[model samples]
Target: MHVLSRTLIDLYDAAEDVAPNEYPAVVMAVMHRLISFDGALLGCGLDAMEHARIFHRSPLLPSDYAKVYRSDPLACRLRLGLRVPVTCECRRFYVARECAEVKRFYQRHRIARVLLFGDPPAGRLPRRWVALYRGVDAGFTRNERARMEEVWPHVSRGLTANRRRHLERHVARRAGAASALMNRSGMLEAQDTDFRALLAADRLDVADGVMPERVRQCWRAGSTYVGEHLQISLQECGEFIVCTAVPLGCAVKLTPAERIVANLFASGLNHRQISERLGVSQNTARSHIAHAYAKLDVHDKAALANTLALDPSRVKTGRTE
Candidate 1:
């Protein structure tokens, strides 16, 4: 337990430097540091037969994981099916010479023991697994297995943190956006600073970790909701709930003159038409339209129309264009 604690700290330290593409490598490295295994394989898959993304892996991994897995004894005992706490010993899956192909693969790599752990899919998150191998001279012991079990929770938490970082970066690629992971009850699990600031400035409230009624309804209705100053989109990532927020209401604080011009444009009035209606010259009407666009943070008529689609009263009435 004492050493595992240090190992746990080291685990998180390694997690901090892991990029999305290299998550499995970091995880394997942490396991190596803690367990001192020879080599490892980590990956994502729909099932044992469907290998998807290999996170971290040993060159020793057989060319055919599904074939080798099916032939292994422990896998046979489990009917090659995944159950909770997916960890198994090598001897259970294979004891040498049982299956000729697997035996040859194991012999070539000097492998005598294998410790496999599988994680099933959650929501949009896919299934993942890790396997550690040890050579013939030193197979794993009971104490070592227990140590791995003890450290398993930290392992999951660290990996989740890495995956979240990956997801956050993906969300950040969109302009003027921020995201968070919330539970179904509207409890805030984790969020970025951008999202936090948006929630702070809006009328939306997070009381006792639950989202306000209106926002929750919007989040549920169509996986998106547009309010006066904000718009939110939601998706389920595995068991993790992702919410993205973009602030567009800042444009609503346009001055009275600009607001009048923007609303006119929103109403399908051209510069000439607006000019005639307001008793202003065509050039003056055009200038007002330009200033209104700048204030509303819209680049074109389309964007202006979308902004106007939100309730007009949502924004504050007066500010200089």
Candidate 2:
């Protein structure tokens, strides 16, 4: 028991350091220490059975395993709903002809027994499961099942911690910006206080943890949305999207043309070059630059560059002209 406790602690600590993709392998490794198994699979998805998605598998299963597993009686039972840990002796649980394909798959892989455990959906967390497989015909003992039950919660918690740490790293990338993690369906999976506050400031309904339709559209289109009070930048991180919202402030005051002129001028283009590049007269280019200068409160080109530098989203550098 002492060793198990220590192992779980180490597992939790390790969750903070490993990348999201590597977390499942770490969990499986920790589980192997507590209970012996030949192969393992870790997955997460919504409460709905059709939504279940596999994230990782150790000692990779055959390519057809993905297609055949859904037909397995045990897997079908799990999909119906897995409220607790359960062990299945394949020969007893599988139907003779109904699950022939899945049975054949198991036979080919030398799998004869299985143990499954699940962490049901909670709040923004998805339904997660771990499956252990054995090649020998011997069924998993009750003691092994009990050990898995004891270890299941920590494994689930470790997954949660891994995702939180990943989102926190994205938040840290931009100082003073509100950060959030959203699923593919555009529901807010997790967010910090700053994120909630920012949403409230925008007058969007965040009570249901749903992103605004406009923001969702922008996310789907792989674009950024500049709102009345904030600018949202979406970055795809694994299965989730990292949303960073920063106050628009004065950056929003400039018109679209003014912003272009400002960026070109800041990129070291003279008024003539800016006009030629933009297909506008030199006077029109100067007029746009003058308007940008006044709106941004910058009197000179150097001051304009410095001001735009503070908000990189406002500047597009790397122009040779």
Candidate 3:
């Protein structure tokens, strides 16, 4: 009992500090103290197992494990939903022909047994699943299964807390901007109220909590997408992506060179200084600034600075003349 209590405490403490990508490995490590396992898989889904996506798999499993699991008969059962914790000896459980591929996978990896635990959906949280695997010939003891059941809730809570902390940190960093956190597969994990509002306001379909295809493309490319309604920027956060969006601003009309020159001018640099810094002629610098002023409709430095400050794509810097 003391060991279980200490392990739970340590899991929560580690969750508070580890990145979202690192949390799974931490959970697996902590679980090893309670149940002897060679590998583990952690995943979550909304409503049904068919939609379940694997977020983490133990290093012991091959890189292709996730791709193979998706089509396995066991995965099909998971699609139905996991109502309680269950243990299975792979060789005995996966005897059917349909489970042949998964069996081959397990045999190749030497995963002899697995214990599955599920955290059903509650309120805003999605359903979560964890599977611990063992390579030894012996099955898990009843006490070990009980220990897993007791610790499963804490594991689920730690995952939720870790995701919340990561999203909150990104939201804080991008203050006043609508933002969301999504898995690499483009599923929305956590989003700010403003982020949803921005999507709705732009009429971007977020059907079933999946980001729009355009946003997913930008996320995959690690680039920014500037549209007529909103400007979306992507930032990589370990195994997840942080997307920040803002309503379109006029500054987007400025050419790259003009934007750079405008920023230099707004920062109090004279045309000669801007020209020298950018290796352009003073006349060229003046020309770019004039074009920027016209495009942004800003007559002077103060207005230009204010306009640039409001530019969602502006790269804020401490550069000075």
Candidate 4:
């Protein structure tokens, strides 16, 4: 194996040793070793609701997060493209200079060489953007981009898998937590007692020691899936095929305005349509929706509807912004 390839393998193999909060540094370390960068910034969960966490190892970063992160040029570029695939999705490689926003940010930070990598499609989880910078005049080379492309698949799986396992536990605490182990065929090779109870509550039964047909279908769809009344997130934990099954709890704690937004949202309305229906501004509608999601402990419109027993398929394909 090439030295860089071996390093990636080692980094992923040791991912569990790092805590979720501190893992960004490890990822940055790997990127630094491979591409030789001066500093790094990693953002996860970039959504219009602004449920994001950004970690930076940059020089002279502002002490106040609001001063540094608010109106962040990069986050704006990213969340602004949440529904627009062509611009939101990076082609496994990026040079900051290629983007005017990135160019301006780099110049302001005195950063020259730059590279950003997006999550692999298979993860289908959060939108993660990793930025690495160099202070001198040299820019990232094609060779380095090629190297990053080679290693990104493993990195995406490892990083997201670890992060999911960590965050899913929090979700579980807020709702009913159940877990199951499945084989390559999506058969339930093992399951906790709570897993059976959680599924049974919604009339989903384990047939002949295998996962339900609905679950098998969802598994085929992606690593994450939300059934009509339950949302399950999956990840590969070592040799274990693990899943966190969170029961859909409509224990939504929203204000009256947010309740209005939630009702409009449940009817499959996007931000703009919801605003028009409620006679509110788009920003106001978005704010209410964000608050509703936070109160319900859901992430996106689809998940929100699923939890609230709403039919999201009826939603028009309108951008949230």
Candidate 1 residue pairs in clash (backbone atoms < 3 Å): 73-93, 74-92, 74-93, 122-238, 123-238, 124-238, 125-238
lDDT of 2 by residue, 51-155 (tens): 233333323463456667767667666666666678877776665557888877777777788898776544344556777888788788888888988888888
Task: Look at candidate 4 and tell me the lDDT of residue 312.
Answer: 30
> Clashing residue pairs, candidate 3?
49-79, 50-79
Please tell me which model should have the higher lDDT, number 3 or number 4: 3
Model 3 regions lying over 4 Å from their true place: 44-62, 121-127, 170-176, 205-209, 249-321
On residues 1-321, what C-alpha lDDT tens digit does candidate 3 reach at each position? 598889898899987798888788788888888888766767665333333333334354634566577766666565665566678888887785666778888888778888887765442444567777778878989998888878888888888788878988865555556888877667677777778778776678765567888888887777897765678888887778888887766556777788788888898999998877888899998999899888777798899999998776797533334
lDDT of each: 0.62, 0.74, 0.75, 0.58
Candidate 1 vs. true structure, TM-score: 0.46
Better of 1 and 2 by TM-score: 2
Per-residue lDDT of 1-321 in model 1, one digit per residue for the tens? Answer: 576677788778766776644655666666776676776665444233433233334433534655576665544433343443344334444554367766666666666677665643332233345667776556666666666666655776777676567566556456667787664556554566577668666677653345567877876776576665677788766544678887755344565666776777777889888777777788887887788777666899888877767743544322233
> For model 3, where is the 10-residue window of minimal lDDT?
46-55
- Candidate 3's displacement at residue 29, Å, is 2.0
**In candidate 2, how many Å is residue 141 off?**
1.2
The CA lDDT at 183 in model 4 is 43
Which ten contiguous residues of candidate 1 have the minimum total lDDT?
46-55
For each candidate, what TM-score against the reference? Answer: 0.46, 0.60, 0.66, 0.43
Comparing candidate 2 with candidate 4, which one achieves the higher TM-score?
Answer: 2
Report the number of the highest-TM-score candidate: 3
Per-candidate Cα RMSD to the true structure, in Å, reads 11.8, 9.1, 8.6, 18.6
